[model samples]
Every structure is written in C-alpha cells, then in structure tokens.
Target chain A: GQQVMQIPQYQHVQEGEDFTTYCNSSTTLSNIQWYKQRPGGHPVFLIQLVKSGEVKKQKRLTFQFGEAKKNSSLHITATQTTDVGTYFCAGQLAGGTSYGKLTFGQGTILTVHP
Target chain B: DAGITQSPRYKITETGRQVTLMCHQTWSHSYMFWYRQDLGHGLRLIYYSAAADITDKGEVPDGYVVSRSKTENFPLTLESATRSQTSVYFCASSESGTSNYEQYFGPGTRLTVT
Candidate 1:
C-alpha cells in the first residue's frame, strides 16, 4: 500500500510569518496535487505538480516537488489570516492497476493569528 | 454553478442501522470518489467510480458500499453502521480519472454514529 506522510500536523504563526509543510510518499508518484480546506468548508483544488524538481507559485504560496518525485513541499510567505486552513498533499502512484487512485497525507493544519 | 452537492449535510444514527449518503454532480464528470475524513486521518478514500456501473474500492472501503447507476449520481451506503464510521464524508468529481485532472468537491456530509 502507498502512504503519504506530512510533517507538522499542526502549525500556528503570526499573520506576517512564513509557514511550510512537507509531504513524503513511500512510493514514487506520477503526479502530486495540493488542496486546501477552510474551516467548515470542503476541500478545494489548489495546484498540481508533475515534473521532477518542479516548482510552481501562486501568489504568496510556493510548491516544489523533489527530484525523485517521492516528496513535495508547500511554503507560504507572509501568511495572512485568510490563510488559516488545512493543507493536504495527495500523490498518484506511478504504476499499473493504480491509476486514478490518490493517497493523501494526513495534512497540515495551519493557523495564523493576527 | 452548482457543480457538486451532497444531501443530508448532517446525520445521526445508531449501531446496526443502515445509512446512505447521496452525491450528485452537474458537470457530468466521468469520475466520482467517496472519502472519509476523521481526526488525525486527513482523508481516506472509500470507493470510486470511473463511470456508470463501474466502481472500485479504495484505501478504506470496508463496511461501505457504493453504486453508480447513472453518470451524475454516486451513492455510498453503510450496511451496518458503527461508532468508528463517524466522520465527515466528502464526494468529489473530475472530468476524467487521469492523474492530471482536478477534482471538484462537494460540501461534506457529517455523520455521527452512537
């Protein structure tokens, strides 16, 4: 079975501080997707990284994929109050009979205090 | 747009009772998935369907069953509910089952079993 592990199960920071969450997969992934869930809300798609050593940015957030495609990270710069939520990384394994299946990490709960 | 919706946003049941959660998507997406979210367990897949009448198990499919009688409807049933099954259930849909597709999630359904 494939597993995706995320670090810092919970994090709290000042509004202006930076935060980072790491995700590692036990198996190589063909692609990885990031999602965010606000308090009392459903998960929403954020971004996806496919190539090895890939890096993508959206506003204050930066996402990076490891060269081996077995790990990924999300870094938020100068976090805002609106950034408080849970961040999850899901990995799609690279192999047969496992297509369309995504293994999600336990997720990082981020809270920013003003 | 009313992309996806889940019925019975909240539910309460007792042991040995049968329960069903309904999921519908207006996008006519080809892929639909059911996942459960609990404390310390971010989100675990229960079942997924590639199309009408084509369903498969996911990471945490035990004690749960799913059916896709039509392209827009995917229902999940619990034959015999247990306290351990108490969690937030989410239904998601995507245009395709490919690894690159982005999933659209519905407002989750919270079920409490006593």
Candidate 2:
C-alpha cells in the first residue's frame, strides 16, 4: 500500500512570518495535490504537481515536487491570519488503476498569531 | 447550488446502530470518494467509486459499505458503528481519476458514535 507522510504535525507562527511543510511518499506518485482546510470547514484544493522536479507558484505560496516524484513541499511567504489552517498532501500511486484514489498525509496544522 | 453536497452536517448514533451518510454532486463527476478525518490520522480513504455501480475499497474500509446507484449519488453506510468510528467524514468528487484533475470536497459530516 502507498503512504504519504507529512512533517510538522503542528506549527505556530507570528503574522508576516514564513512557513513550510514537507511531504514524502513511500512509492513513486503519478501526481501530488495540496489542500487547505480552515477551522470548521471542508478541505479546499490548493494546487497539484505532476511533473518531476516541478515548481508552481500561486500568489504568496510556492509548491515544489521532487525529481523522483516521491516528495513535495509547500512554502508560504509572509503568512497572514487567513493562512491559518491544516495543510494536507495527497498522492496517487504511479501504477495500476487509481480510480481517483489518493493516499493522504497526516496533515500539518498551522496556527498564525497576530 | 451546482457543486457537491453532503447531508446531515452532524450526527450522533449508538455503537451497534447503523448509520448512513449521503452525498450528491451536480456536476456529474465520474469519481466520488469517502474519507474520515481523525484528530491525528488526517484523512483516510474509506471507499471510492469511478462511476455508477463501480466501487472499490480504500485504505480504511472496515465495517463500511458504499454504493453508487447513479452518477450523482454515493452513499456510505456503517453497518455497525463503533466508538472508534466517530470522526468527521468528507465526500469529494472529481471529473476523472487522472493526475491533472483536482477534487471538489463537500462540507463534511461530523458523526459521533457513543
């Protein structure tokens, strides 16, 4: 079975600080997706990384995929209170029929203080 | 009004009782998934359906059953609930299983089994 591991189970940062969370997969992944879930809210899709050694940016956030397609990282620049939430990384196994199945990491809970 | 939705935002049931969670999507997505969100375990997949009548088990499928009678509906049933089964459940849908597509999650159902 495939597994996705994320680090920094919990993090507290002052406003305007930076944050980063790493994700690793036990096996190669066809793609990896990032999600953010606010308190008392459902998870929302952030971005997806599919290419090897890929990097994508959205406003103040940056995402990177490992060259081996087995690891990823998400970095938030100048975090704000609105950035407080749990971050999750999900990966799909490279081989066989995925059928839209994903292995999710334990998630990194982020807390931002003013 | 044209996205994914889950019924019974909150529920409480007894250990031996049966409980069902309903999910509906208006986009006619081909893939639907059920996941349980625990405190430290994050989101663990329970079951998934590629299309109507095509379902498969995920990482944590014990004591749970799923059916996809039509493209828009996927229901998860707990045959005999347990105390350990208490958690927040999320239903998500995607247009396809490919790596390029992103998932849209519903507001989630919080179930407590006593």
Error of 1 at B105 (Å): 0.7
The candidates' interface RMSDs, in order, read 1.1, 0.8
CAPRI-style grade of the A/B interface in model 1:
medium
Question: Per-residue lDDT tens digits of candidate 2, residues B1-114?
Answer: 769999999999999999999999999999999999998899999999999999999989999999999999999999999999999999999997455668899999999999
Say which candidate scores most in DockQ: 2
Give the backbone clash total of model 1.
0
In model 1, the clashing pairs are none
Given candidate 2, what's the lDDT at residue A30?
93
lDDT (Cα, tens digit) per residue for candidate 1, span A1-114: 899999989999999999999999999999999999999999999999999999999999999999999999999999999999999999988877653668889999999999
DockQ of 1: 0.78
lDDT of 1 by residue, B1-114 (tens): 789999889999999999999999999999899999997899999999888999999989999999999999999999999999999999998877455778889999999999
- Give each model's whole-structure lDDT: 0.94, 0.94
TM-score of each: 0.97, 0.98
Where does the lowest 10-residue lDDT sum fall in candidate 1 chain A? A94-103
